[model samples]
Target: MRIGITLTDSRGPDALTRLRDELADAAANGMQSAWLSNIFGLDALTALAVAGSQVPGIEVGTAVVPTFPRHPVTLAQQALTTALAVSGRLTLGIGLSHRIVIEDMLGYSFDRPLRHLSDYLDALLPLLDGEPVDVRRETVRAVAGLTTPRVGRVPVLVAALGPKMLRLAGARVDGTVLWMTGVSTVRDHVMPTLQTAASEAGRPPARVVAMLPVAVTDDTEAARERAAREFEVYGTLPSYRAMLDREGVTGPADIALIGDEKSVRARIEEFGDAGVTDFVAAAFSGPDAARTRALLGELATAA
Candidate 1:
């Protein structure tokens, strides 16, 4: 399994400046990859490009960039530029963001998202493969191709939850990127469905990138309470709520990896056993931030 660390959350004008330093720290400690989350602050792809150049020997990627706003043509250009900056180390993780963000926030109609995703792949894949995308689809339009001598195919993983999206990821893209999904959901729902679809399409096995909250702390209850406060928004999101229910979990704290060192390490191993190919650790509050980071560094190697 591949082990990656989520760059510690930073939201400020200095966030971009801090990203490279964070990635440098992760790579120095033992992480193989560093993932950046897209938010109102730093642009994830841009941050990865900057971080990747400075932090050698560590893979850098966006946990996801939303697909609704950027056209496939522009998205392809941006992804290629970022990969070029990193010497082909960028794995583009794209997604159809929640309706709250898409229609409610951005004011884009969220009509037939599954269809939009299908149309998106049809246009985006060809561009990544260095072929001219001359077709127009219902949700995307493109008439361009990358001229930046294809160093190698930049892997694409879609953030998916439902069956149709998982199948779509398997059939077209390299794999799926997940957040707040549990072991049971991955084992019984995600893996089987994705594998079957890729197999039927005669494609190689698909990748499963799972991201989870992790905290290395002796005060389990206190850590859980802190986690409950920090990541409460996810519990209310419909897609995340469905997955949590499937895991028999009451809240995000239930899936969080919080315990003494040994127990925390064991929980990470459980994810590997459940068929997660890549584990992204979102380290939360602990007694000592430095100690927590040190523990995550150890788990990252085993991850």
Candidate 2:
């Protein structure tokens, strides 16, 4: 399985510089890819364009950019430009962000999200492939094509959790990128649902990129407590809550990979054995942060 690390910005004065340093460090440590989340902080695509230009040899991607905020045409344009800037190393991950963020925060209607994604991709995919887009669907409409110089088509991954989303992802996109999901869910529910949809669609086997908080430490209880506190909100989100339930786990803490190096390594191997295509580690070992990264780097090199 391909191994990578999720890199986040601190939102500090030198956030861009720090991001560049982090990318370089990840590459130097032999990581195959580095990913950033598109939250309320820095624009992930733009940050990667600037910082990733300075760092070579490691692939960079967005864990996800919410599809609600940007029109498909505009996103296609930006993603294409970013892909060029990053030397065709950009994997664009997108999703229909939760109702709370879409409706409550962004004041956009979150009804019929599945339809929105279907419509959004209808326009977005053609544009990314350097073709003219004239799609007009209920949730999205685009009539134009991009003028940006062609880089290779960007690989798109959807942050899909439920069966419907998984089917949509498998039928439409390259693969699915998962968070707050466990090995059991990946082995039984995710792999079956996603692969079956892809097979029915006559597509290649879908990639499963599993991401979770990881910690290599002796204080397992403390790590669990920290994970519970830091990632508590995910357990409350309905989508993530469903994944937790499907995994037969109570909360995010229960799904976290936390223990000494040996235990943590064993759990990660379980993900690979369960058919994960890529394993992205969100290291949160606090004082043992360096140690955790070292282990990830070692594993990545070995892979």
Task: Please give, for residues 76-133, the per-residue lDDT of candidate 2 as tens digits.
Answer: 9999998999889999999987999999999999989999999999999999999998
lDDT per residue (tens digit) for residues 45-106 in model 1: 88788778877888887888999998887788888888888889899999988899999999
Query: What Cα-based lDDT does every candidate model obtain?
Result: 0.85, 0.92
Model 1 scores a TM of 0.96
Which stretches of candidate 1 lie above 4 Å from their native place? Answer: none
TM-score of every prediction relative to native: 0.96, 0.98
Error of 2 at 159 (Å): 0.6
